[model samples]
Target: MKARVHVMLKDGVLDPQGQAVAHALGTLGFQGVGEVRQGKVIDLDLAATDRATAEAQVREMCEKLLANTVIERYDIEIG
Candidate 1:
């Protein structure tokens, strides 16, 4: 089984890194790019065969170590 976790900041939070990227893009002549948010994707290979269990485990991983729940939200995808 494979699990993919996406971690991102919640809205109404200040994202200096995202704003930096948007500024750099404009400097490079890219236009119409407004409000860019940065996030991360974590791909995991699990030995568990059950879909529910795998999702649970991955969600635990995100809550425990992968994501900063205080300022971010995460989504889990199992395959």
Candidate 2:
């Protein structure tokens, strides 16, 4: 089984890196950009036999170590 995890800032969290990138892009002549958010994607290959088990493990991984739940949100997809 395979699991994909996406970790991103919460809706109201301020992302300094994303802001910097957006600012730089604006300086480079990019226009009409409202906002920018940055996130991370992690791919994992697991030995679990079913999607349910894989999903559970992925969630555990995210909660335990992959993401900081205080300021970030994570979603897991299994295949």
Candidate 3:
């Protein structure tokens, strides 16, 4: 099975890296760029054959270490 996890900061959280990118974009003459939020994508190759089990395992990984649940949220996709 393959699992992909998308982890991002929740709304209202400060994102310094995102802010830096936005500022840089403006400096480069990119116009009208609004708020920019950055996140991470994690792809995993798993041995589990069942989709449900893979999803559960990925979700657990996110909850435990992949995401900082307090200020970040995650979405999982399994194939």
Find the candidate with the highest lDDT and give its number. 3
**lDDT tens digits, residue span 5-52, model 3:** 999999899999899999999999999999999999999999999999
Which segments of model 3 are wrong by more than 4 Å? Answer: none
Over 1-79, each residue of candidate 2 has an lDDT whose tens digit, in order, gives 9888999999999999889989999999999998999899999999999988888888999999999999999999888
**What TM-score does model 2 achieve against the real structure?**
0.94
For candidate 1, what is the TM-score?
0.96
Sort the predicted structures by lDDT, highest score first.
3, 1, 2
Q: What are the per-residue Cα lDDT tens digits for candidate 1 across 35-69?
A: 99999999999999999999999989999999999
Once model 2 is optimally superposed onto the true structure by TM-score, how far is the C-alpha of residue 22 displaced, in angstroms?
A: 0.7
lDDT of 2: 0.92
TM-scores for all candidates: the values are 0.96, 0.94, 0.96
* Residue clash pairs of candidate 1: none
Query: What range of 10 consecutive residues in model 3 has the weakest lDDT sum?
Result: 52-61
